[model samples]
Target chain A: MEGTNFQRYLARKKAMSAYTWNEVKKHKMLYLFLFPFLLIFATFTLAPVGISLGLSFTYFNVLEPPRWIGFTNYLNLFLSDDIFIIALRNTIILATITGPVGFMAAFLFAWFINELPRFIRAFVTLVFYAPTIAGSAYLVWLLIFSGDSMGHLNAYLMRAGIINSPILWLTNPDYMMYVIIIVVLWMSLGAGFLAFIAGLSTIDEALYEAGLVDGVRNRWQELWFITLPNMQGMLLFGAVMAITSSFAVGEVTQNLAGFPSTDYEVHTIVNHLVDYGAMRFEMGYASAIATILFISMIYAKRIVSSFIGKIGR
Target chain B: MIGAAKKDKTSASGRRIVKVSRAVRKPNRSLGGDIFIWGILIIFGIFFIFPLVFNINQAFKPLNEIFIFPPNLFVINPTTDNISDLFIIMSRSWVTFTRYIFNTVFITFVGTAGHLFVASLGAFAVSKYDFPGSKFFFGIIITALMFNQYVTAIPNFLILTQLGWIDTYWAVIIPAFGMPLGFFLMKQFMDTIPVSLVEAAKIDGASEWLIYWRIVLPLVKPALLTVMVFAVQALWNNPQSLVIHTEQLKTLPLAISQIIGSPHAPQVARAGVNAAGLMVLMMVPIIIFVTAQSNILKTMASSGIKE
Candidate 1:
């Protein structure tokens, strides 16, 4: 009986290989079409990621040969690094706030815009999308929050007697996180938003007509019965984008508040990684931070997907 | 079975002309609702619109007007001095200003085109085919989509150096081709295309490549253009100082940053020059976006809440 079972297993394995070979033979043209992308993806993307993962456990600082030290970097990062803790805490706060807010805002605004005439809809889309496409335009936010009395917000507020003096908006740790969150949301005009707009447009109008016939009387009911269910895929796409972007809030914070903010209050996990990776030349530790971030994000996406699945059920 | 779904799909979900007419006819249908929606839009518009307005105003202001106690919102008199001064300041650089434009345009065009074609093909394979590793490749891209793009920069830099791509255009454009967002997006959009459409093509002896190129590509043009807009936006704004090292290879952002942030410029260090540079950095991309705005906006129709 054991010999027969072993033989059966071997035969199954052989069948699988033969089937796979046949698949390759049949899809040769498709494989040829896919070849260039897979080559670049493997060489540039996959290989580097794999190498970075390996380097995470080492002590290489670019000059020296890598010395494997197991999980020392990870241990230090979690157990002892105070700045890392602050960054981690701030990142979670940012992700929780901006992720949901941006995701919902994208869908809601796109849905609203879809109600307009085509020409006006296009104009409105460009207007809303201006913030994202306008690179470094968020620097205007710095001018708004500038410490000088000449700053726009300060001047207006002072004229209205809203404050005694110009506040150190970018510097003061108390206002740093709030200001960063606001700027982030302002610039949250992203690919996902455009994708949502496009997604909303592509939604078949007949679905709404059928829903109206099916007793979907008001816009709200129409939205629920017709729109949301249809946009389920795009919703998932938006969520994935939102999660990645919200977690990657370091760029905006570093640019606005200045990297290594006063009291390090505005620091994020990506900033912490940058502080190690770019500034300190500790590639291993930086890779470790990246690995943790990558894993955490993947897990976050899983939770988001599972939670999204439960909605509208 | 596929034929039945195809017939039903055309009858039930084919473009609804009546629904569009009803929406257009109902313009004054809800005054209060319009006010609410427009109210929200106006507020968000202020947030989104301020940057473009501010840049234009700042560029035209004389030095005195810029630092005045109560800042003016719009320019009273627009001048060409800033533009002229920026060109003069830029003359001091090692490379010509046109070289910078050429480099930027080169990278943006090549990067955008490469990304659209390659990413869509990758997406097409995963969406339309089933092979041993198709599921795995799809899973890989999804997993890739989960992480921040900036995470592997150091490793990428090291690999590029090893490939002798550190100072070349390939260093910039190659990695962009691997950006996973377009792949994810194209796949999502392709998933919306009726499988029966592809089957109809297949029944006519259409090869897989032909089916994808002709039948699938045209159907997903909006998504293609949307992805193109995204790729263009990224490559256009990409800083020269970040990727390439050569002075001649410096993209627009790097050149602008250098002049704007230059500590020891006599005339160019002024805020006017900075404003001029900002406008320059901004206008080209804005013009391109405005030109291609229709194509980009086409994605809006197909990308939204689907049935």
Candidate 2:
């Protein structure tokens, strides 16, 4: 029995090696086609990630040799960095506000479109979605909050006698987070809205018919039992997108709030890392922050996926 | 079916009577829904268009008029003075306003074209070829999609620096070629194509290249256009990457930033510049989107892909 088992093991190894070689030979052309892309992707995407992971454990300042520090950067970031904490807080705030609002807005817009006559629905969707292509959503907000007497929002406020003095909306730290959140909602509304619209379009019309037959009356009932359940995948997808976007909240903050808000109130984890990682060249510390952010995103993703799976099932 | 038809007919006549009575009682309700839709649409339209309109208005207005009380919605005398001044400030030897435009156009075109080629080929491989590691390749693509650029900015910068690629168009165009989102969208669309066609092509002894070019390429036009729209928008709106390599090469967003950050940066007129820059940057994408709007939406809706 022992001799036969050894022979079986040897036979299995030979078969596996042959299978591997056969796969290599059969797909040789495909590999050739994929070579350039794989090369570039490795250099650009995979290699950087691997390097960053390594650098997270080392103390490197771009100019000096990378010294092996072994989790010191991570420890220091958690223990001593006040800015990182502030960044984490701000990012959470922005994400928390933007995610739900944006998701709801998109879902509603999509549902509204889906309910409309087919041709008109397409036209309205195109128009509603045009702002996304226009790339001036943030610019519109800038016009509204120009921080001066001639600014549109301030001008309207003054005319209405709401306030005697123009409010420094962008400059003031108190309102900066709100301003960023509003802009993010505006910009993100288009994409997520479109996603939800797409998701709504996929809900088997038969499901709605079934709901109607079962006496699922009114918008709320239809939404809870029919729409929401059918759109589970999309909701999960949108949530992941929102979370990732929240983590990477740099552009609106940088553009509208400007760098280092009054007391760093508007700074996010991304902004902090960008300042240190790119500007100041603190490679080790920046990598640590990035790794933490990445891990959090993965955790969020798992939770979202599980939630989607439960709903889908 | 007959009972439902009878019920529909009864409901229609009953609704007609109610509609007549209701119209008599509340005339406005007849137009109320239409009015409400139009009102909402107009308000949102204005909200959407105001920045571009305001900026265009500001760009043409005299610098003094830019800050006029109750800021002019309509510029009385639209002039090129600000634009000419902008040109003068932006011009340095061969690098002029026209040069900036040229640089932006060139980068956008090259970047979009590169993305189309590489992403399509990669997508075709992943979708059609039952090769070993195809799944692994696709997994990598999806993983890359989730890997936020913000997190990878440091490592990407380090790699670029090591390669001495900073300040070069390659720094922008090369990396953008393998857009994972574009690849994924294309793959999803390509998956719907009948595999029998590819097999038939193989039976004819056609090379993989010919099969892709002749069969897969034509079949995936809509997806290609979708990818094009995405690529153009991404490259055009990318401001951060431009910041990394800021020396000789300047894209539209970066150019606008330079104007904003310049010594003569008009405090109030900055709003106008912001608007004008965004408007100009947005024009190309809007035009492309309008031309391919139907195909784009159909592909998006049917394929269930999002950026």
Candidate 3:
């Protein structure tokens, strides 16, 4: 009986390989089509992650060959690097606030605009999307949050008698994170937001009608029963977009608050990574930083996906 | 609420009458809810639009008006002098302004085109076919979407150095081809296309390449435009300063920033020119988005993660 069972398992494995080989042979042209992208992707996008993970355990500063370090970077990151702790904490706060807020705002605005007529919806979308596509237009935020009395926010506050002196909105450590949050949220209505608008529009109108017939007496009830469940795919997508962008909030801080921002108050993991990688050429340490961020993001995404999977259930 | 429920029930029962009346199916939206939503939208609209308006207005402001106390949102004495000054500054740079434009336009065009072509081809194959490892390949792409460029910057630099692509157009354009967003979005959009359409093409004895290029590509125009817009936006804004070290190799955004001077530049004198340069820098992506947005919306309609 044991011999027969082993033979059966071997037979099944052989059959699976044969089937896979046949599929590969039949769709050989499709592989050709996919080759260029996969090659580039493997080199640039995929390999980097693996390489970064590997390099995280080494010590290299680009000029010298990498030396095996054996978790020294990770140990330093957690136990000794006070700045890394601040960055990690700041990243968590930024992601926690902006991720959910951006996600909800994307959904809510999409739902709101879904009720509008055709052309108006398109125009409103442009209005919402302007902040993102207007490349470097985010520099406008520096003007608004400029650290001087002549700055827009400062001028307004001073006029309103809300403050005795101008608040150095960008430079002030106390106000920096809030200013960054406001700017990020302002620009947060991005691709995910567009996806939500599209998702809302694509949700079958008949489902709402059917839902109404089934005693879904109000818009809110209809939404919970029909709309949310229908667009769970988009909710998941939007959430991922929101979470990833929220985690990668270095550019806003770098540009607005200035790099190595005001005693590293607005420093994030990405900034820390950039600080080491670009400025300092500490490739191995930066790779370690990148690995932490990559793992944390993947972990965050998994949690979000499980939660989104249960939405409207 | 009771009256509406009664009406709805009657309408459901008298289906023919309901069909005519519900031709314009405005769902049961309360006046208060409508007001509240509109109010919120308007407030958010201001929040979204005010900064952009202020920025654009600054481009038009005369030098003195730019430095006015409280910084007026509207420019009273608008001038094209700043725009002219921006051109003069660009011309006086060590590299010709057209050289920078050529570099940018070349990079943007090649990068966007290559990305769209390669990504869509890959997307089509993955979406329509189920060859061995197709699912695994697609899984990687999805996972790639969960992170951004920051995480990969270090390894990417090393890899580029190995490839001898640094300090060349390929450095900027090549990596863009691997940006997972376009491929993911293309696959999502392509999934909505009927499999039967491809089967029909196959029955007509059309080659796979022919089917992808001629039949399916045309059908997914919205996705193509959507991807193009995104690619263009990214490449256009990409400061080529990262890998391309040569002054002549720098892109438009870098050139524009130079003319705009630093954020620390004396704001009173440079404000008008700075604003003008920024406006010029921003216009390309803005214009591209505005033109392609309707198509983007259409493409995005189907761009959802499959459970």
The C-alpha lDDT values of all candidates are 0.78, 0.71, 0.86
lDDT of 2 by residue, B1-307 (tens): 2323343444455556434665353211223343444556557656555655566676677767776788667788887777566555567535566766777888888988988888888788888988778987887776576677877777888788788888877788888886677877788788879999999999999998998899999988988888888888888767655335554577766776566553223455454554444555666666787787766755555444222
| Distance from true location, Cα of A304 in model 3, Å | 0.8
TM-score evaluated only on chain B, model 2? 0.77
For every candidate, give the share of true A-B contacts it also has. Answer: 0.50, 0.37, 0.74
Cα lDDT for residue B273, candidate 1? 76
Task: Summarize candidate 1's per-residue lDDT along B34-142 as a digit string, tens digits.
Answer: 5566778878878778877887788888877777778887887778788788888887787988998898889988988998889888789878877768877877877
User: Per-residue lDDT tens digits of candidate 2, residues A1-313?
Assistant: 9999999999999999899889879878778877777777787778777888889999989899899999899888878998889988887787677766766666766765665556787667766666666664455566678788877788989999999999889888878888887667656654455567766777786876677568653344566777787666457656666666666778678767777777888998888888888688888988888888888777766775675566523
Provide backbone clash counts, one per model: 14, 1, 0
Q: DockQ values for all predictions?
A: 0.33, 0.32, 0.60
Best-fitting candidate, scored by TM-score: 3
Best by lDDT: 3
Model 3 preserves the real interface contacts to a fraction of: 0.74
> For all candidates listed, what's the TM-score of chain B alone?
0.80, 0.77, 0.90
Q: What is the Cα root-mean-square deviation between model 3 and the actual structure?
A: 3.0
Model 2, which residues run further than 4 Å from truth?
A: A1-17, A119-123, A135-137, A198-237, B1-53, B72-94, B240-248, B262-274, B302-307
Worst 10 residues of 2 chain A by lDDT: A215-224
Q: After aligning candidate 3 to the native by TM-score, how far in Å is the CA of B51 from where it should be?
A: 0.4
Question: B192-284, model 3: which lDDT tens digit per residue?
Answer: 889999999999999999989888899999999999999988887768677898989888888887666666543556778888888887788
